[model samples]
Every structure is written in C-alpha cells, then in structure tokens.
Target: MSMDPVETFRIEAAELLEQVEQGLLDLTHRLTDKDLVDAVFRGLHTLKGSGAMFGFDDLAAFTHHCETAFDRVRKGEVPATVELVSAVLSARDHMRSLVEDEVTQTHRDAGAGLLADLRRAVESAQGKSSAPAPVDPAPVAATQDAPAPAAQAGWKLWFSLPANAMTNGSNPLALLAELGELGEMHVEADTSSVPPLDGLKPADLYVAWTVTLRTDQPRSAIDDVFIFVMDDMQLRIESLSAETEPRAPAEEIVAEAPSIAASADAPAAPSSIAPRAAAEPVAGSGDAKHGKSSESVRVPAERLDELMDRVGELVIAQSRLSQLASASTDLQLRSVSEEIERLSGELRDTMMVLRMVPVATLFGRFRRLVHDLARETGKAIELVTEGESTEVDKTVIERLADPLVHLVRNSIDHGLELPADREAAGKPRTGQIRLSARQAGGEVIINITDDGRGIDRERVRAKAVASGLLEADQQVGDHELLQFIFHPGFSTAQKVTNLSGRGVGMDVVKRTIESLRGTIDLTSTPGKGSEISLRIPLTVAIIDGLLVRVGDGRYVIPLAAVEECLELSLEDDLRSRGRSFISLRDKLVPFLRLRELFRTGTKPDPHQKIVVISTGSERVGLVVDQIIGDHQTVIKSMSKLHAAVNTFSGATILGDGTVALILDVGHLVAAGQQQEAQLRAAG
Candidate 1:
C-alpha cells in the first residue's frame, strides 16, 4: 500500500530534526568548528524548505528563524555558544511537536518564547565577539577547465522538475518566487518539452526553466532553493559576471523586457519563450548525475511485521507437511516436502534479516539525554558508547528503549557523585557512563557502566531490612543485595528528587526485561563503579528449539541455551535421585526433574537424557524422558492465566498439532542457583 505523502514528510522531517539535534550537541564540545556550523545550517535549511513544499506553513515560518540564526553563525556574524545550541535544541523539540500534532495556542506561545530565547542567544553571542562580520569576497573568474566557483556575483540556472512533480504536489512557480527572494532575477520558461494536446499528460510536468539572478548570495543558496527536489530533478547552474552577456545562442536570445525582471522585493513573474538550443554542459557541473535513482526503498515497519506473520504461518504449514511426508509411502510426496522445508527455512531467515536494525538507532537518542542531564544535575558527565553497530530485532530495540533510559538516568542520578566529591575521592571531576552491547550466542548483552561511587551495601541492607525484605544481620552476597534496588518501592536515596530517589523506575525495568524473556545482572565494587548487564534474546518471533518429552508432555528448549546432552543412566539417576545433581567433567551441576516439577505421575523412560543449558555463568540440567530432535518453534505469548508460570516462557504448536511449552532458561537458571545455595546452607 502506498503511504500518505503527509506521513512520508513526517518521517523525513523526524530524521532531519535528529540530524539538527546531533549537530547542535556536537557543537557543545567544539564551538569553533566551522564544518559543524555548516552542517547545522544545511540541516535547518533543508528542513525549512521541505516544510514549505509540504504545506507546513507554520513549521516553515518557525524554522526559518532558526535557519537564519545558523546562517549568521556560518557567515561568522555570530559565534557558536552553548547558550545558542541549547536554545536551538529546545526549539528542535517544538518542531517535532509541530510535525506530529496540529498547532494549538500552547504551541504558538511556546514557539514565541523559544524564538525570544533564540534572539537573546544570538544577541549575547554578538556581544561576546567584537570581531566584524566577514565580508563576501568578489566573484571568482570562471575558467574553461576549472569548476564553477561558488563565490559568484551572478548566476544563470536551467532546471526541470520531475515528471511526477505536479502529481506529488510540488509547485515550480513557488520555487521561482523563492529564487526571486535571493536578489534581482529574470525567469524565462521553455515550452519546448511540452508535447501535443493528445500526447500531453495533465498530471506530468513538461516545462523547463531558465533563470538569471544577480545576487550577493553564493551558489550554495541557489542549491538550497531546490534542496527537496535535487535528488530527482535536472538542474544546471553556471556562474556569470555582471559585465558578461549570457552565453546563449542568437535564436535563444528573445527580447528582454523590464517587467520580467523580478526584484528581490517583489514576486517572480516568468515569461514564456520560443524553443532554444539544447543546454550546453558546464565544466565540473553535476548535470550528468541528474534524475539519479536511489538504491534503497523506505518500508513501513507495520508492513514488515505483517510479512513476518505470513512467513511464520508458512513455516508452520511446512512443518505439518513434513510430518505427513515422513509417514507417507510415496517418495514424491517426501521429496516435495523436503524442498518446501528448505525454501521455507530460507524465507524465514530472509524475513528475520529484514526485521533486524542496528542498535545505533537506539543509542543515538541518549547523547541528547546525557547533555540535558548534565545541565540538570549541575555535574560534569560524559557518556561513551560502544558496539553501536550490533544488530537486533526491531521489536526488541523498541521495547528495550524505556528500560535503557531508566537505567541511564539512575546511573547519573544515584551512581555518579558531584565534581567536588569526586575530586576529594582522588577521582576525575567528570564522571563517565559507558554503554556497550555485543552479541553472545543468540543473546545480546547490553551493559551500562558508570565510573563513580558504587552501590553502598550498607545502605541497601538497611533499606532491605527496614522494608522487611531481610532480617537483621542476615548475610547476603553482594550480587543478591544489589538486586534489592529493583524491588518495588525500594530506595537508598535520602530524599526524593526529579530524576530518581522515587524508586519507581528500577522495578519497572526488571519487569520489562523479564517480559521480553531476558535477564539483568548487577555488579558493583566498593568506591569504584557499578555495571548492569541485560542479556536479551536476538529475536522473540521464532527460535530453534530442542523438542524434548517430559513425562507425557513435550517441551521446547531454546537451542542457544543448550550446551550438551548427557545420558542419565538408571544407576546414576537412582544414586542422585534426591540430590538432583549431575557430575559433568568432575564438576557437580544442579539438575531439575521436570516430572516432579510438573507433578506428573508417569514414570520416566528407561533411558533418560539430561539437557545441559546455561545462561551466562550459570548452568543447569533438565532430566527428560526423551529427546525429540530439533524443531523451528514459532513463539506464541502465554495468556494472562499462565502469566505467573515462570518455568515456561511461551508455547508453540508441533507438527502433529499438539502444543508444546517453551522453557524459560533464565528463570530455570536462577532456580538452579537458588537450589545450589540452599543445599550449601543446609550442609
């Protein structure tokens, strides 16, 4: 389905806004960087022009002020300052609201206030720098062998819009009017491309234009006039000197009329002329690359999701066909099933790749968050990101964003100390928060670490004890004690503040991670730092699972978590019956008996299997009646009635149509670890 043009503009505007914010944030570090200044200006310019083309007059008008401010910075009329960047950053947020929602009184008032601040920032910057604004240089002489000079005093431009321009709601006359705003101009339309009445397409654009302008603005300003249409339109710009006549054939030189000369103060009124000779190519002109096609297409996320669902359904049907083929006597049926299985597998992999997106998209937003946090807390802080190129399921990225935000905010608010305190502790005045991610097996490990005062064990214990979560003088490991921070309404803060100390965020983070079938591990050192690692699966839609039979019921274990399978002989099983521990390579590993856990009265098979699974450093063994080979499992969410069941993450249908439960590896590992601790305490 074709997307609404207005919706498409919204997406493009969002990306432009992000670019503007990133550039402004970068300027906060290097205020004198000219390249950054130019980038900021270009982003703002393109956004304003595109907004106008899309009929967002309010946005276009509001953004024009910001574009002009940056233009001054680009021209050395004003210097880049933290104050200026902050004002623009705040305004960039308002631009997002303008794009997303309709304008209201509140929005108008907010925009006015932001523009007022922007004006003050520009004025303040002007006062700080007493240097005179740089003067525009004289137009450079053009050479036959050299590129067109950008510092031209006058320009002659010829351009034609794309055939679909009219259909896509573009206005060539409005573009001409904007060019007239640059300076004194003369425009002549060439109707040579227009076909006969029967051959003409009303919705298509066929008219080409020739425009000559005398202005102090550089060639870049002309390019900005067509920024939105540059990728698909034919455009040629040639520099001209004031004294030189236009390089045109005698037949092309029609009578020059005074009324056709568009003044900077007036709207453009272009005239139509007779057919002229084909435009001559200028040296170093990018005319050859006009109407270039893009290599990639933008696809909506919902469409991708719908396609994934179809692929998943196909996989299930293929599995059923394979099952029937295995029991069939006909060789052709079996062969067809095998081919379908292979093709379905390939399609599933391809669909999975389409749904994967880089973690960089998730990490980029935090730079702005950290910048704001530093100002809010009055503390010097730096954020370092690593492994941003790691790719994960798009759904996982979306769900993980809020949890990461809560974690980062808590790190800044609770983990880091003020500059004076840090200096007194013989540490750097500026605290650092490092966020990194890497893939391990089928899981992505995202770690958020902060270099500052670590979690205070004493305070955590006090809070836990006071909240009745622990007894007085109860002994607990550092890892276990730190987890108390994630308990509901638990806090070590002396008083509540805006960022943290309310104790509402961490528990939600824990719940959200658990809902995604992921686990969180917290580690800290005294007076050093703290690190929180969240291990989440690469995708939740489907997985390769080991189909195993426990008693009369069958279950699926995630293949990523399976280490190795060992035979549980009747001798070893009876000897270790009560202990529920298995000996592996001379080391003891805790094991869970599914029959007993599910309270199934059916006896185990004579030959049983112990499937070894591990999550991070913890490992556990599951004793099952039979190992039923591997299956491609499509994960289906559990109903609210089974939400309390921690042993199984979800359920899936088998080839024969029976439902099988998918094991929750993280939950089982924690259970095994708890059992190990209990056994040790009892001994």
Candidate 2:
C-alpha cells in the first residue's frame, strides 16, 4: 500500500522538530555559535515551508514566527539568549501538537504567549544592537511574517539539477517562484541538454537556469531555493560587480555555444522540459531533507513490526523442523532440513539487526526536559550524555522513555539543590546530570546519575514512619529501605510543588520497568548525589534460550544470561544442601533448585546440571534435570491468569510443539540473594 503524503509530512515534521529542539538546546550552551544559529534557522525555515505545503496552516504560521526570530539572529540583528531558547523550546512543543493533530485553544494561547516572549527577547536584543551599530536597517520587531529586505547587492546564480530531478518529485518551477518572491528577478533556462523528440525522456530534467536576481535578501535565501537538490546538483552564485550588467547573456563569456534562455511567454515546448510555476506547484522532488539520503525508504513502524512477527513464526517453524529432522531416518530429508535451519537462522539474525536502533534517538528528548526542569526549579542543571551509539531493540527504546523522564524529574526536583545551596556546600553552582547507556552481556544498562544532594535518608525514614510505611523501631538495610520511594503517593518533600511533591512518579516508573521485564537499582550518598540504573533485555520479541528440563517439565533460560553449564555432583548437592551455594573462581554464588521452586513433585535427576547466569556483578546457579541444548525462543507473553507469577517471564513453543516456560533470570537471581540472607539470619 502507498503511504499518504500528509502522514509522511507529519512524520518528517516530527523529526524536524527534534532537530530544532536539539539545535536550540545546543545554542543554550554556546549562545554565540553562528553555525548553530544558522542550523536552527534552516530547520525552522524548512518546517515552515513543508508545513504550509502540507496544509498545516497553523503549524506553518506558528513556525514562521520562530523562523523570523532566528532569521534576525542569523543576520546579527538579535542575540541568542536563554530566554529566547526557552521560548522557542515552548514553541517547538506547540508545533509538535499541531503535527499530531492535537491543536486546541490552549495550544493557541500558549503559542501566542511564547511568541510574545520571543518578540520581547528579539526586541531587547535589537535595542541593544541598534545603538552599537547605528545604521542597522532591520526592524526592532516585525509581525505577520514580514519579509526581510533583501541584501542591497545583486547576485547571479546558475544551477543544473540531476537528470532524474523531476522524477524525484522536485519541481524546478516552484523554486523559481520562491526566487521571484525575494525581489526583482530575471530567470532563464538552459535547455541545451534537452534531447531530440525521438530521444526524449519525459520525466528527465534536461534544463538548467541562470538567474539574475536584484534583491536585498542574503545569499542564504537563494541557497534555500536549491536546498532540496544541493547534494548532487551543480550550483554557483556570485555577487554582481557595480560595473557589470546583471542581465548579460551567458554566451558572452563562455567559449561553448551560447546558452538559450527560455522566456516565460515562450510557447509551451516539449512536455519533457516543461517548467512549473511556484504558485501551482507539484509535490517535492523526493528530496530527503536535513541531509538524509534519498536512497532510504520510510516504512511505517507497524509494517516493520508485522515483518518481525512473521520472522518469529518462521523461527518456531524451523525449531519444529529441526526436531523432526533429528528423528527422521531419511538422509535426504535430514539434509534439506539442516539447510533450511541454516537459512532460517541467518534470516532471524538479519531481522534482529533491522530492529536494533541506537539509544541516541531515545536520549535526544531529555535535553529539552532538562532545560525546562532547570527553569521551573530555578536551578542551573547541566545534562551530559555518553554511549549514545549503543543500540537496543526499537520496542525497548519506546517503552523506556516515560520511566526515564520520571527518574530525571525526581533527580532535578528532590535531588538537586539550589545554586546558592550548591555553592555554599563547596560544589559548583551548576548541578550536572549524566545519562549514559551501554551494552552488558545480553542487556542494555542505562544509568541516570546526578551531581546533587543525594537522597536524604533521615527525611525518608521519618516520612516512612509518619506515613506508617515502616515501624520506628524496625531495622532495615539501606537497599530495602530505599524501596519505600516507589510506594504510590510517597514523598519526603516539605511542600507540594508544580513539578513534583504530590508524589506518584517513582511508583509508575517502577511499574513500567517491571512490565518490560526489567529491573532498576538505586544508590545514593548523603552529600554526593544519586544514581538510578535500569537493566533491560536487548530485544524482547525473540531470544536465544538454553532449553533445560526439571522433573517432567521443560523451560528455556535466556542464553545471554547463561554463563556456563556443568553437572552438579551428588556429593556437592548434599554438601551444600542447606546453603545452596557453589564456590566458583573463589567466589560464592547462590544456586536455586528448579524442581523444588516449581514444586514439580518428582524425584530429582541423579546427575543434575547447573546453569550459571549472571546479571552484572550478581550470579546464580539453576540446577535442572538435564541440559536439552540450545533453541531459538520466540517469546509469547503469559496469559493474564499467570501475570502475577514472578518465576517465569513468558512462554515459548518447544521443538516438539510443547509449551516451554521462559525463566525470568532477574527474578531467580533476586530470589537466590534473598535465600542467602535468610540462611545468614538462621546462622
């Protein structure tokens, strides 16, 4: 099915908004960066143009104001300041709402208020610059998207598009019309490349243009006309000397044959080289805006997801085939099945690579969040990020966003102190928040660390006691005590604030993480800030699992979590009966008996096997009846009736079509740790 242009525009606009936001955030750090200023202006300009073309009038109109503000900054008429960045950041959000078809009166009012702040900031900068340079011609404030007066000099521009330009959806005529809007213009086409009637390719662009423009607009304005085709198109622009005539024909200087200038009144020539006017334009020439390659295609996320589901089914079918091939006596059938197994495995790997997206896309939104939080709390917060290139499953990235937002907010609101307080405490006035991601084994570990006053244990304990969440005389470890923060409606704040203090954030964060089959760890020091680490699987849809047996049932342990498999001697089992601990590499690792945990009500295998799995620094051994080799497991969520079960995360189809439960490694490891604690207490 073909994609709708409007939907495509909305998607592209969403991306453009990210660019604008990122540029604005970067500008905050380096206010005087001309390149950053120009980058932001160009993003806004393209958004305005594309939005207007896509019939998003409100979005275009709103974005135009921001574009105009940045345009002045581009021309040194105004300065890029925090206030301007903050105002534009707000404007960016409104643009997002419009793109998503969520525009309302509230958005309109907020847009107006933001625009007013933008105007004041621009006017304030202009008032300052007006005196420093008395002859500045730009207005202190302009409204209704007034065009800036073109630069006072004339310019000559020549551009030749690629042969497939028209086929790519770019209309050269629309570009000419935009040029016309700049100022007095004389446009001529060089149709020298046009083939004869018998040789013509109707969609091929065989013409070039030499435009003599007398406008007060900057060179960037003319550059914007060809921005869509700038990558491969040959373009040249030069300032016209005072003595040179702007309208001179191109053949006057060239040694080759004189160029033919097609007149606007010229009778319509061959359809192949027909020109389009800017007013009545065609769709874009398939120009991948913002430096993206035209060779790439935009597939709906749903389509990719559907493809993944099919691949998952194929993996299961392959598993069943592998089981059949092993049992078959026919050599030919076995050979064919083996070949299919290899191909299916390769296809599954390829499919997984397609689903992996860099974590950078997930981290991009936090810059804006940090900026707003800084303003709302009246604190100076700096966000530093690392390991952005680490890739995780697309689904994982999507689900993680909300949880990360809550953690960041909690850090800024309750963790970070005011600038004066930070200064008095012998720390830098600006509190720093570092968000980093990395791949650890089969999981992605994301850490949100801050340089702020850490969690106040005394306050937390008092709040817990007052709320009856804990007994005053009851002793608790720091790790267990911290769990109180995730209790719904729990807060230690002295007073309620707009951003926080009513509680209800950390608990949601915890729930979301647990839903993804992930775990969160929190650590803090009284004076030295806090850190929250989230550990989640790299991909949730499919996994390589080590199939094992316990009693009469089977289970699949995530192979990535599996370190090694070895037989547990009967003597060792009896020796460590109560402790359930194994000594490996001089370290004591806890072990869990799967048969006993599942209550299988069957005798244990004489020679049981131990599967060692580790998550970060923690390791646990699972003693099973037998190691049934490896299998490709397509994870299927457990039914709602079993949703509350903690030992098993999901179930998968086995080689023989039986339902094999997928073990929840994180939960098993935690259970092992708790068992050790109980054993120590008994001792």
Q: What's the true lDDT of residue 439 in model 2?
A: 93
lDDT of 2: 0.79
Instruction: Please tell me which predicted candidate would have the highest TM-score against the true structure.
Output: 1
In model 1, state the lDDT of residue 533.
Answer: 94
Off by over 4 Å in 1: 136-155, 162-170, 197-203, 214-223, 227-294
Number of clashing residue pairs in every model? 0, 8
Predictions: Cα RMSD each: 6.0, 6.5
> What is candidate 2's lDDT per residue for 467-570, written digit by digit as tens?
89888997778986887898898998899887788878888998788667678888998899999989888999998899999999989998988899878977
Cα lDDT over the full model 1: 0.83
- Candidate 1 global Cα RMSD: 6.0
TM value for model 2: 0.85
Candidate 1 lDDT by residue in tens digits, 1-683: 88899999899899999999999999999999988987888888878877988888889999999999998887677889999999999999999999999989899999999999999999999998877866432122223311344444676676766566666556899899999999999988878767799999787667778889987666657766776666556565555552243343321211122211221122111222222322222111122232332346788899998998899889888999999999999999999999999999999999999899999999999999999999999989999999999999999999999999999998999899999999999999999999999999788999999998998999999999999999897788877788799899998989899888887888999888977888898999878999999999899898989999988899999998899999997888899866888779999999988888888899878888999998766789988999999999999889999989999999998888889999998888888878877886777
CA lDDT of each prediction against the hidden true structure: 0.83, 0.79
Q: Which 10-residue span in candidate 2 carries the lowest summed lDDT?
A: 251-260
